[model samples]
Target: MDLAQVKKLMLRHDGCVALKANTWSESTFTALQPLPVEQRGAYCVLKTVELVYLLCSVHPLPI
Candidate 1:
């Protein structure tokens, strides 16, 4: 996902556009660092991975 798409998904989670509360916090700072500088969209891509691991449910919710 692009940065815009990542931000859009984040809107569903507490309206958090960025990964962390403070600029210098760990996750926020990590997301700012691309896995590889030459890799295209690596920043957003990294965020996408984190979002999946952190937010995605492991089991189906009962309705």
Candidate 2:
């Protein structure tokens, strides 16, 4: 999928997801699914031998 499609899908998700981050990659994209309310605004941390990655969300937290 393209950025526009990803952005659109993320926008439709109901949760507090990250809209921006320091970097991005294909792995940064989470599986499209319903997130729990408590898990909203949560950031996914992926650790590898060479690098540690963070995955953000498209859903914005309430102001």
Candidate 3:
């Protein structure tokens, strides 16, 4: 999606957006890197993928 769509989606989803980076997919960073700072909304990079994998691997919660 284009930047406008991405921004709108994020706003619609309560400003919670998760961007994933891996060997297989186009990196979200690369796509947004060229945009001027003003166009880029607030965001943070987190270890969400690792944390999710770890959580699932251990099955910490009762299913």
TM-score of each: 0.30, 0.22, 0.27
Tens digits of per-residue lDDT for model 2 on 1-63?
Answer: 144544554567653344444334333444313556555345343222112111223442232
lDDT of 3: 0.45
Question: Could you give me the TM-score of model 1 versus the true structure?
Answer: 0.30
lDDT of the structure predicted as candidate 2: 0.37
Ten contiguous residues minimizing lDDT sum, candidate 1: 54-63
Q: Which ten residues in a row have the lowest lDDT in candidate 3?
A: 54-63
Off by over 4 Å in 1: 1-25, 28-36, 58-63
Root-mean-square deviation of Cα positions for candidate 3 versus the true structure, in angstroms: 12.7
lDDT of candidate 1?
A: 0.52
TM-score (C-alpha, index-matched) for candidate 3: 0.27
Residue 22 CA displacement from its true place in model 2, Å: 27
Tell me the deviation in Å of residue 29 in model 3.
0.4
Local distance difference test, each candidate? 0.52, 0.37, 0.45
- In the order shown, what is each candidate's alpha-carbon RMSD? 8.2, 13.8, 12.7
How many Å off is the CA of 25 in candidate 2?
16
TM-score-superior candidate, 1 or 3: 1
Per-residue error (Å), model 2, residue 62? 26
Off by over 4 Å in 3: 1-26, 42-63
